[model samples]
Target: MKTDDLITVLARDSSPPWRFRPVLLAAICGSIIAAAALFFAGIGFRPDIAEALGSGRFLFKFVVTITLAVTASLAVGALGSPAGGVRRRGLLLAIAPALLAGAALLELAAIPQSQWGRSLVGHNARFCLTLIPLLAVGPLACFLAALRFGAPANPGLAGAVAGLAASGIAATFYAANCDDDSPLFVMTWYPIATMLVVLAGYVIGRKLLRW
Candidate 1:
């Protein structure tokens, strides 16, 4: 079939007019459940989680990660609409990194220079890199499949956004398991894992999301 014909088939709205947000919402919820299931099965929270919750650095991890997840998911959800509201909210994606950066600066100020290296290295760097993408597998698959229900002009961007959302979700779960709550570690390793997922999404999106 011709490219135009494929686009016509995908862009056509022959069936009843259904909302994409609700479907997107379902995808988000279902993705969470899937990721959580995989998480608990393989990696539960750190044994000291009860005590870790009291630490400001530890609690802040959730703040950054959940913000990433929410903002990216919001952007991905808007990709289906003709208005392209994702562009406006697209800046929201930076909020997580901004928060992390600010927190990292504060951490550097508060701690001695000698400790910065240790804090950045952390005990779980390898696990951090491995588990985040592993946990993101389910969410990324769901997000990619869900993208088909919408008409995103830039499928690659949409997929990358979905990857961000998936990575956020996965990182949130992995954070609980990770003992290293330093912003330095999160800033270094988490983005690497996220980029991996996003790269996969972009490559896959080019093929899978072609109208």
Candidate 2:
């Protein structure tokens, strides 16, 4: 076929590669399963954790609401852009985690009460360290899947999807393990974590999805 003819055909038939579907499906399913497990496991809330952090109210509901909003916003933004171009995306992703970790560290360190500061530092560090790996896995999986199957026309969409998947997984695990059933815990920790994961997704999508 002539080059121009081939180009026309490719353009006319353009669609996201088929491999992405299964990866996306797995991510979605995994997130749902994680959330369900957290809910049914009799781990409803953690007042003690909230009290320690100094905010105690409707923890589960607050986290869920905030999570939904953050995830929706990130996903929408990501979907609006194209995927690939690794260098820039990767840098952005790398910076996100660093920024999140730094912010948490600074907050924990600046607390005036030594006892409380120590407690907060321990809690935040433990939570971040443990959750970061698990949270990263979901996005990494999605990135690999996107690459294997071929990225979407919009890389941003992939980032958003991956971000949501990452956040859901992280939140489920956080709920199950942390035991801090307070609005304060969710309000503070969840947003910070989500921001990190979304940034990671954006960077990963850019680098790994490069066509």
Candidate 2 regions off by >4 Å? 1-12, 15-23, 30-125, 147-150
Clashing pairs in 1: none
Model 2, 51-115: lDDT tens digits are 63453323443346334534443443333323323343444344433443454455456555555
lDDT against the true structure, per candidate, is: 0.87, 0.50
Q: Which candidate has the highest TM-score of all? A: 1
lDDT tens digits, residues 87-181, model 1? 68868988999999999999999999999999999889889889999999999988887878777777888888899999999999999999999
C-alpha TM-score for every candidate = 0.91, 0.50
* Candidate 1 global CA lDDT score: 0.87
Residue 94, model 2: Cα distance from true site in angstroms: 24
lDDT of 2: 0.50
List, in order, the clash count of every candidate structure: 0, 9
